[model samples]
Target chain A: MSTPADTMKSGPRGRSRGTRTVIAVLYAVAVPVVLIVAWLIWAGVSPQIFFPSPIAIAEAFVNTWLGPSLTNDVIPSLARLGVAIVLAITIGIAAGTVIGLTPWLRELLEPVLEFFRAIPPPVLIPVFTLLMGITTSMKLAVIVAGAFWPVLLNTIDGVRSTDSVMTETAQSFRLTRAERLRYLVLPSAAPRIMTGVRQTLSIALIMMVISEMFNTSSGLGYRIVYFQRNYLIAEMWSGIVLLGLVGVFLAAVFTFVERRVLRWYHGIKETERA
Target chain B: MTTVATAPERRRRRLSGSTAALGILGLFTIGALLEVLPRIGVLNRRFFPPSSEILTTLIEQLGEGAFWTAVSDTLRGWAIGLTIAMVLGIAVGVIIGSVPFLRDVTSSTIEFLRPIPSVALIPLVVLLYGTKLQSALILIVYAAFWQVLVQVLYGVADVDPVVRDTARSYRFSRWTQLRQVVWPTALPYVMTGFRLAAAVALILQVTAELVIGVPGLGRNLGVAQSSGAVSLTYALVVAVGIIGIAINLFARALERRILNWHPSVRRDVAR
Candidate 1:
């Protein structure tokens, strides 16, 4: 996790550091541009139907996604992902806390929890569809089911690993269960909880696309498949581009949120390492 | 500190008689509840078959050739995909990590592409290959490759600078330097990546099959759902779950064996 600046400090003894950094930045910028240009050239040369020119994809991207599909497909997908994330965080934290705090409960339910965790959450999509019949609710259920496990499992480990001294100190103060959880246990587990949340974000995004792929009309996943089935090759490629953009956006947001939430944890780790 | 972190988990793994008994009891309680809920009409009978019925259905599936074929199909996709990804990832990661300039050049592009969910490529894959195993392989490889590559890159970056400089001063051949100085440091990270990629490969394998109608347990599960064979779908899910657990156990054991010389594994053994 060392910064590029840190690495550069120990970099080979050579030309000026400033020049090296500028060169590094230029290379970083050049690589992706070069790759895209190469793709464009390849597309223009072969002219395969499946491999549309980058220009054609760009046009299709604006025409297809910047229009009604933005509201119809993209917005709904993001909303479902957003809602499922919230629900997963709440349910996972609640259930995980209960399981984590009680020794007997943790021991008793470990096998059952392991069984469920082992079941790749994707397989539950059909079952959820059958039970709820291809509704938004079912999609939400699919996503939340998939996204919650990391949160739940991490929360259990985090809560269980709370320092024994800290727990005893809280007990000596006669803190009620609610008070202890609020001020002591929860704060101690916040870093791990944030780790879970980070994982949940990606899982939620994946599940959002997945839940839409099955028997649904208006989402990014459906639109992409729809375009493909109709042989709108350019449009399908554009849909994928949009999905990638959304993924990048989610990752950037998660980084921002993690920095804010785990600021103290990072500070502590720095001092401990030093 | 590492031993302290792992001690409780190791103890938990070697479950006491009472804890093991309670765990099994807890599993039965869930099973019994699953059986009772549908029978008592709390859950719909059609969608949520009783546990006994699902167990019987699973047993029936074990005797069927189609079931074994689906299982083998899924495993084939997962294995092939994982092998390709690991090879590509390690090779690319090592080459990139060794050259600071190359690492800097590729970092941004890799970051940009890595987060794009592999499922997003379903449309493109389905278009190019239809429902073939290649479609599933593309998705699985795409998803798993980044996991390994990123970890390996970090591992390479962690190579001790003192040792690297000494190797250079000694005028060791490039291959000798890499083999002697870099590979050992990176092996632990590669193992971490392998474990991660295995799980991801399986998930993507099942996903491609389910969504794209590729031949696998996921395809069977989907077909069962559509056909209203609810118990059969549940059985397929259980079978997939077992496979997942087996893969996980295998990965962990492999990691321990391969990294026995590493401090992380050595510490556990000492404990």
Candidate 2:
């Protein structure tokens, strides 16, 4: 099957370098410029409550988010997100690989996993609060659960789809089950596992915010909701904007990491070395 | 070794048809253990009620008219939000992806908007729509939109340029080229987007209901929990879980049927 990254290579390129740059600059700023203009017009014309202008938002961004709130709220949120992501990826890949190797185990767990997975993580806030209180542990628990399924499921699929030829080669060699899994299975499944991790990143971010928003304090989620509840509209907008920036940064980081990790896969495909 | 019946036993273990029974058995064992655990005081009965009691509550819920109302509301939110997302996602994703200039222009915006966790917008959405159905719609749509949009963008980007040039050489109209050349190549991605958006939409719908106090199963679960109705809360949660399984199975079935021509689907079929 063809991969998306493969399309970039060996495909026709139709633009000059200067034109490409012009297009890039124009395209990059178009939405922001248009949205700012629209915002200015809306704020100028109506002057309604809770509708802060773009300038108000910018100030709100710096004033509210630039100080202790950045350390107190934003740092905690990002920290929780980081922990949840690492936790999910470790458990998901391990469990998924183990189960995928034992196909019957995967099947036996299907109905069970699907049922549990479908229970939206938000619905557990009250339960978690009742049991674990609004502590960091409770938040981490929900975040891990929320971010886990994609990685686990994708890993299972990836491992199961490892080529029969690869499996046979391992069998023909004097490799133990552990060796086969570590050497043959994992390397073959890395691409799909990475895809799953990318999916998990977004879910972890959402879970981080939602878990914080519900009956909690000391995170961007709590801070954002706190601002809104107190009629601090500008501050709330700023928090949301900050949250957006955090997401962009995380995604950019993920793509860069993914490119590095997947470099070998791409390199082999491009050069037909495989 | 299964004594002298090793071959047959091995076949039964390996086959999905027989493994399905094992799956059912596993579920029953887990259910029985859950029923026993709370009663035995292994788990806190106050918070983690027995499975049987939860099942009783589930049965009672099914007989109640309000339960169905909440269920319908949840489904409605999922349907409407997913529809809006698919339409907008496909339209914008295709346009931006096809036009190289537009792709470059909108890349930053899409990257920025796509990752802004939808749950973070609960505050802004609540302010705009105020715990209404529209509030739920706003969250669900925003959350699911990115799933479909990204997939559609990839789909459009993956279109082979040779076919595109052929269409142009034949003087095929833009609309015709899109329908004939682009749609087929992108259909698989669209289906993928649909499945993903469907799941995300449901998750966000429940979330909106739970967090924003909207009218759905999630809201009912929240009420049940706060009122100290432990068994009922578990029951409602189980109901949501069942609904999720149903949706997933339905989506997989649809994908298999729709994408029969695709190699992955064919591979699954052959297996």
Instruction: Write the residue-wise lDDT of candidate 1 on A128-183 in tens digits.
Output: 98888988898989999988998898788788889999999999999999999999
lDDT of 2 at B125: 87
Across B1-271, the per-residue lDDT of candidate 1 in tens digits comes to 1222443364446456988989899999999999999999999898889999999999999999989999999999999999999999999999999887778778889989998888999999998899999999999999999999998998898887778888889999999988999999998888889988998999999999999999999999999999999899898899999999899788878888888788876766675
**Interface RMSD, Å, model 2:** 5.1
Candidate 1, what DockQ? 0.62
Q: Candidate 2's error at B126, in angstroms? A: 1.2
Quality class of the docking in candidate 2, CAPRI style: acceptable
Clashing pairs in 2: A27-B105
Worst 10 residues of 1 chain B by lDDT: B1-10
**Consecutive 10-residue window with the lowest summed lDDT within model 2 chain B:** B1-10
